[model samples]
Target: MDGFDETFDWVVVGSGAGSMTSALVMRQAGKSVLVLEKTGYVGGTTAKSGGVIWVPNNPLMRQAGEQDSTEAGIAYLEALAENLPGSTPEKRRAYVVESQKMIDFLLAQGIPLARGADFWPDYYDEVPGGCKTSRTVTARYFNKAELGPEWAARLRPGFVSQPAMLSEGLKLAWVGRSWKIKLLLLRIGLRVIAGKLTGKQWVSAGAALQGRLLKAVLDAGADVRIDSPVRELVIADGRVAGVIAESGGERRRIGARLGVLINAGGFAQNQAMRDRFMPGTRAEWSNTPEGDTGDMHAEMERIGAALGQMDQMVGYQMTRMPGWEQAFVKPPAQSLTGKPGAILVDQSGQRYMNEGGSYELYCQTMFERNRTVPAIPSWAIFDARFAQSYPIAGVRMAKMHQVWKDSGYLKEADTIEGLAAQIGVPAEALQATIARWNGFVDAGHDADFGRGARAYDQWLGDPFLKPNPALARIDQAPFYAVDVVPGDVSTYGGAVTDARARVLRPDGSVIDGLYACGVSSASVMGGVYVGAGASIGPSLAFGYVAARHAAGLDNSL
Candidate 1:
């Protein structure tokens, strides 16, 4: 590809983690870049995410005393995934191998970054070669002033209401434990005081991450257009050359001299796409932002770019009310049903899998069981004690919204049998299930599904609880049941890409000038939720890779 003056060297579609990184990288490499976003908001699904990035064997991991290896990461990917399109040995090696380069690139750009939570273990910590410590990093507390007033106002809020580091959030989650919580509060208080004295206003998590990238793009003089979506790709000489974007009832043809990269996210918001590809999931079942409607996916399909991973999503366990199912919310530590006195039961009122695994794993269980059982909209039963301990969603026990209760989102009763009756499940079966679960609780072990057996479960559990922190007898009065279902933090399926992040045709040849990353590309992790920030890590790496190659720079290292 030859560089053409008057046209941008690269045109990036979308404003998520991947697109922003691509724009930043190209602009930094002295290439003109343009970003087109479908919505008024810049951060696509990323703005709605918890912004820790998983990098295998990251420098921060080493500095934090975790001797993780790329080999171990490769092994973990291979062991966990099966028959995923891009999980080849070479690509997996590339993802692991490029972690440091990406980290170095962001650091060189002066992005504030530090080690994320050490307690944030890999999704499967018990498996062989699993990383038990922080291989993830987050943007350090960023002063919103870095984005200036207008841009700062547009940045999305963090996933959690708590604007603190992941480590601090983990410590602050120990609400029931007196001593540990007090100490954690004292540490946070000191940090807050120091910040006030310095007059540096700080924000953490996804907002900080996107703000840094957005700032880098803006500072590098990249052009960004909001409320603009690429509706069609202009293909010349069997290569993508430009895009026709529509805005305000008019269309404009924007030429790209280098390449067109579509990081416009997945079909999570499209019900037709979900039904055809990912079954049993509707638009209401995902945590993806409103703009991810798979419009670009449809546009690219017309150009013969091969796509896969439609059957997969980066699934999450979520609670949904009846009519408000489409607007799913991520579970805070308080809503995690694996906590003491809470249990998940299918329509038949029976436990299926361990309630206390990774959220994605929990979703996998629901999907697998739904093939034969009524597990899609499972019931999460908890005693009054559990509700009193933590907020369900954002509502405390006393604050359970009237609309939520009236709309059949929550079923409440003074006894488990009565609660089961209200929810239309078998009272006898639920009673038996509770009796069996209570036996396991009293015996200090889960004899049925091993709920509290794994380190991953205990990582989110209360340390001070006896027997098992994730288990408690549900013998208390005023039982409650909420409808929990499958949801996604992001979709893993998208356009297939090669080693260089170029979109591949059905016959496996590159589409010449087309590339993709983030949720728009088939996940490099093979749809396996490897660890915290897994999706963003590959997005950053391949976004960098796509830009470098499109600019005629060496990407073969």
Candidate 2:
């Protein structure tokens, strides 16, 4: 302790959900824990996301009578993972087994948990052992008052700041079609009104999730420091022992007797890193907060931690609108492009891939197509039917501003050929593509790419559609096009670690006393995103695993 300004049994860098979870685990073991966050906010990128956790055989799912097994979960992961780097058979098994335990622990601690919509399908539900009924879980709505005014103000806000649960938020897509959705809207309205009278600050999604975790950590007596950025991991006797961090406008050395865990997030905001690894992507297209600049990634690498899957990201396709950079939520094109009466086309006005699959695969295909075609800024062609029936980037089609057209964010024309001219694609090619799409709609089958063939694809489509939910004739007048870019919620690659969450060297040797989880560690799902909350699920699982190992306990089933 003499070599440090202060010391704790465990030091967690970053205030992401996983970091808070690890802190709770340490405190539950009666060990001292310190959480150092670089920003004034307590929650990291996890707070801004959907906050869904993908867990197979979770207690919430079992309570809801949803059936799942550890073997089936492992099979599902193994089917997709398939020897991909950063994911192993053992790691996959650990994720399936320990994630359930982690969720159980959180629930036992009184954290409000709920199962995601039963209709929500896994990204690759067609894969072996994949569940058509969702295995996702989310935190219920939490009032910020639970953390008191001081701590509540520091909780990071989500893109959807509305207090609606994630399930309620999904119902917005069926607004005019479903009677249940109408009822849900009425309920949401009343809730909003009640909040206006009660002075209660409610949050849902990622904000609710991290808020609950932060509360648990605080209640367990863990120390959390905001605006404290760890600059270096102090090594004593060739092992991570402490950290040199900036605290209260001064650099302070803080020691960790047990170990140091890095959950500090990925390098989504660092343009240089993006260019080096993901050459086609841009930092401007990222949805993560500016604090996710990959400082911990560089530090870990410098200290001999092997990095893997450096080019991967959680692709979340987004459409740019006026002032998109400043907007809390950029208009999402993931669902819109998959809906009836709309199809995505490259610069040459050619449809290349299935448009109604997972957003990750959609963006990956966009990049893959860009290798030979200019598809980075692809065109999403839609007709008046789609425009009138659905919302674009949360704005009703009738409410669209003339400024959007003037700024070229939304292009419109009375005919397909005219719309093609506006977007600088060949008129004939555009005409041919639309005709082919209309033919597919009539046939009730997408022979080209099978857009609506999967349950997951149809979930994103309009259920009211007859033949195929994801297919409709795009022959209506007043065609429109918008720029769809490969935006991301966060980078997916980072420091390589073993199944126990211990950082590993290139030669498979462990870095003693150093661990990583969340996006700071190489993803456990490999290159493919397995489900709705695959990112956060493994983060929580590995966090629990790391803490249990540090406590000299076994986490594996």
Point out where model 1 deviates above 4 Å.
1-6, 160-163, 175-180, 183-202, 321-334, 401-408
Give the Cα-based TM-score of candidate 1 against the true structure.
0.92
Superposition error at 483 for model 1 (Å): 1.2
Alpha-carbon lDDT, every model: 0.79, 0.89
Candidate that would win on TM-score = 2
Q: What is candidate 2's CA lDDT for residue 189?
A: 84
What is the per-residue lDDT of model 2 for residues 1-557, given as tens digits with 9 covering 90 to 100? Answer: 66999999999999998898888888989999999999999888899989999998888888889888888889898888856557878888888989999999899888898987777888888888898888999998888888999999999987665668998899877888989899998898888888878887888999999999999999999999999999999999889999999988799999999899999999999999999999979888888998999999999999999999989999989999888888776678887797888899999999998988877788889999999999989999998888988888777767665888878788999988899999999999999999998899899988999888888888888878776778888978888999999998889999988889999999999899999999999888978888899999888888988998987777453
Model 1 clash number: 1
Model 1 lDDT on a 0 to 1 scale: 0.79
* Residue-level lDDT tens digits of model 1 in 238-331: 7899888888877887889899999998889899988999777767767888888998888778899888777888877777654454333554
What's the count of clashing pairs in each model shown? 1, 0
